[model samples]
Target: MIALTLRQRNIIEYLLSRDSYVTNDVIASNFEVSNRTVRKDLEVISAYLKEQGISLVRKPGKGVWIEDKQEVLFDDLSCSYSKNERIVIYVTSLLLNDVNTFMTLASNCGVSKQTVINDLNTIEKFLDGYHLSLIKNQGVGTSLEGDETDIRRLFIDLLFTNDHSKIVYELCINNDGIQRNLDVSFELITVIENEFRFRYVDRDRISIVLSFLLNRLGLMKTKNSTIQSSDMERINSILSTKISDSNDQEYISSFLLGERVEGSLTLDSKVEDEANEISEHLISSLKKIHYFDSEDMKDIIRSLTVHVRAAIYRCRNNIHIRNELDEQVRFAIGVMYEFTKKELNVYETKYNLNFDQSEISYIALYLASIFETGVQEDLKVVIMIVCTFGLATSSILKSRMYQIFGDCFIVGPYSIEEAEKYLESHEVDLIISTNYMSVKSTNVIYINPLLKQNDIEMIRNTLFQESFMKMCSLFFNKNKVVEHDYHCLGEYISKNDVSISKGKISWEDAIRKAAAPLVAKGDIENKYVNTMIQAVNEFGTYMVITPKVAYVHAGKDDGVNKNCVSLLLLENEIPFGSFNTKPVIAIVVLGICDKEESQLLNIANILDIPENIELLKNSKNIESILSLHD
Candidate 1:
């Protein structure tokens, strides 16, 4: 008897999996071994194969291959499965089929009981991800423990790893349970698709049919799974099979009903009923949460009805949306996001449903779009420029301010005495003077006669602060006006608001380091950092708004002590998620105050400019970064 080591088996398996010859270097690299070791391994395998009338050929540049003309020897070797792969398959079979005993798994997988026990350790790790466990009891032998929905989702994920083609092939290809009945299911799908004038993704169509067949064959279990009586009768007539059990019709019925909503294509009775019910509750919840316009209430309700229907279908099926604009949308519509999530929570509680953050983010995106259309124009910042450098210089400064701020501010050039007189009568948001002024109002910024990039940043900060104060007054405090010294990006950067991460770090660590300066300054608490990280874990890299930049922020309610922004630059780029092609190099942690809100549009606008983004990514000094606005 011959015993093969795991490495030898892996080497042979790797070579066999490939159609062309594999280089010793590639094989060694894959297994993390030296090329010499790989060559030695090949030599040992070659010596053994020669005795069995098999040839191992090694071309100079092409690499190594097996040339067994009879194909008998290699075919035997191909049947050998890795212990780990066998374990996964064995556990999957146990979870899905009637094979529950340790003995059955061992026999089915051609492994020893001890080997199966060792494999269980690895299997436990895999099941832990789905919050599931593999338990072996004296009476029951072995069983899986988890929510039925989560367990099924885990099974599907393990089976197909997001590949729908493999799902169809595994469940429907020449299988005894579905081999005959699939034709009837196919006909049913065609009839339904045509009658409803709705299309189903081929993958989803096959899965629906497969779910029905598997449920019927007793290979899979669907908890509380059912179909309408009318649908059941129609399906039974089409198949001419007496589906005596009501449960037998449920899986197909739910799938069909879900498919109609998932596509958002058909407005049939079933979809309409589900959509209206969910949308009415959602809209009512939103209205209760905040004051909004009722002018386009019907249109808004209709849009929500269709969206919620689709969202419900997806949530149940564990389908996720990959929203690229999630971070930007969340940042821009900060309060609205919280409002939308709270409203969705109402629906979740009522229906016993779970909506992932991505779904909530999608809803927020739609709401933000609708809300933006009705945004009341901002009250322009009124500035009275007091220039010590006479009329010509003051006029130039005023013109430049107007050029830069555009509609954001109303700039007026005035002498120091004239500014005092104007301020006595008119309410000015800010005072920009060439020389230092002993003004009564604290809202004053001093800049040089020649406005530089740094000057624009300062002016932007002043205006942003004023806008934030207004928002705070409107939202939280209506009595006293909120006041705070305006801090520009340059001041923050120069005041050591930046943390440069040197080596490879996790996204969580990157965020923590980015926000550490603010945390140290009592701008935000530790809980806020954890909350931001948790949000990323739940919703993915929706925070990565642009390449090399991530606005890592959670809701204001999540431990925000004050409104602040800190920047962290990474020397080594780290991958965020599917959203960015380039790895993230900058993490801008935004700590938003619960009582006060800042307009992210200005920040977004500055970062939106490619040149500004480039400067932020490449610059090491505050001066270079400020030059971006110029």
Candidate 2:
């Protein structure tokens, strides 16, 4: 035979198995390799086949096929046995079947007469253990004789001496065939005859024959086997007269034949009593191990009942095996039932206590603590500006503070005494007192009643400086921005119109018209401008335009607190020279700020561009900006 690589051989074998030809593309796709590699492997196989007298032909654009052959040459190479060894076994078996003429037998097996004689000598050695003799006459064929029973028994023992005997015994017991004590190694003839008769008989007759044989033969001896004490008890209980008396034989036979057994009240009562006892014990043990709800417990009990009933039926019907073996089977069933019962108990207990009230309370507190630690430290300065009356100045201060600091939880407008009382028990991290009232201690930072843009800027810088960033890094890295800050900004843009409009106005005029009111109120200027510039540099380039309502004055009683701040992006930078306000082509400023204000201030800080504002107003493309919410 020509030598071939494993891959080439595999390819050849695959082609042989197919009835029709396969394309090279189909084979390449199936193997997930390049077509070139597959073709190279196939070429090797084709050359090897030709050398071995087999022709492999391929038709262009069609496929490959093997040429016709009178005999399968691969089969000769496939067999592991030598040609002489194969002939020896074939000749010997033929002779044993009563072929007398040596020349004819030799001719039939395709071997010379001398080879047949050589094989006969080897056969003589093969039959040594069987103690049988082969006699040959000059005119007649060879005959096998001498203790045929012993010879058959020797063959049977050889075939069944290992694992097959145990498998056959199990098969017989499970199928409700004749139950016999499988302990003895009887003569092969006896076993074969009995098996033949058993196969042809009815269920009752088979059962009777099995019972008689087991009783007559006695128990088989098992050595060094681990048989537990409880196993013995279970076997006794199953084979006891109360459960399997002779009077119940008919019903037992019916049950074994896969038919429902009825008729005997005594038998029915006994089986039911045993099943109920087992079911009750399983339920009680399961309950102790775990807490199962009523419905779940009931389902488990139903399953246990089915298992017990099946076990009882098997014990009653299986009479071919000895009482000891039957008890062992029942004991195994009992152990399995006990194991299931314990597991169900544990499951019930664990599931019932999953989310008790105390657990929920702990979870809520843990979540609150997580939120406290995760909020950006720079945004944590919660200032409440206290004034005599709840009016314009307080609102203006609030808006200005928000524009400077990204977030601040401001609580304000309380009287001096009211502020002191509220701060006594409430959490006030920082207090901004606008009025010159005598405050309690040094922890409070008092600013002038008329606040300036630089003052607010200094406060923001001091609050969220280097020390605060370090503190924030302890809980979370700088790469992870807070979701709530962005959420607040997006939500505010969604509810307001922050669009810019084209006009005959200079950028400085727009900035003054928008920012001048807040600036005059001691709220805007360099800090707000710098903060807006920083925001615009970080985000993309944008254009800004003046709003039509930019000139509207805001007051406490005007019922129109025009603290409107909008965001817009433009395609190009409109020509504006550097006069702080010139680069900022559009302007949006709040007249007054209050606690109930929306997110316009944050959006303005995020997108600080005059051209962008103009584009946004003209295009009304708020959806793209607002998509940050998702």
Best by TM-score: 1
Model 1 lDDT-worst window of ten: 475-484
How many clashing pairs per prediction, in order? 2, 21
Off by over 4 Å in 1: 1-88, 100-113, 122-184, 187-191, 197-199, 203-242, 260-265, 268-310, 316-498, 501-566, 570-585, 588-606, 609-630
lDDT of 1 by residue, 59-81 (tens): 86567887764553544552334
For every model shown, what is its TM-score relative to the native structure? 0.43, 0.20
RMSD of each: 17.2, 35.0
Q: Which lDDT value does model 2 have at 216?
A: 24
Candidate 1 positional error at 391, Å: 59
Tell how far residue 235 is off in model 1, in angstroms. 6.2
Model 2, poorest ten-residue lDDT window?
544-553
What digit string (tens of lDDT, one per residue) describes model 2 on residues 1-630? 555543555567667766766656455535533455678767877777777678777875446766654433554432122344433334334322444566765654455778667777666665655676667777786665555333433333322232223322333343322333322212221342243232221333234333333332222221111222332333333333323443223322322321111221122334345555554554454334333453634543444454343334433432111121221111112122223333333333532312211112222232223323334453365666676636677677666666765566667756789888887777654566666666543124455455653355335433532223223222222212322344433555423444444555543344444454455445444355443333232211122212211111122222324444443332323433221111333344443333234333234333333343444445545465554331
Off by over 4 Å in 2: 1-17, 20-53, 56-96, 153-630
Maximum-lDDT candidate: 1
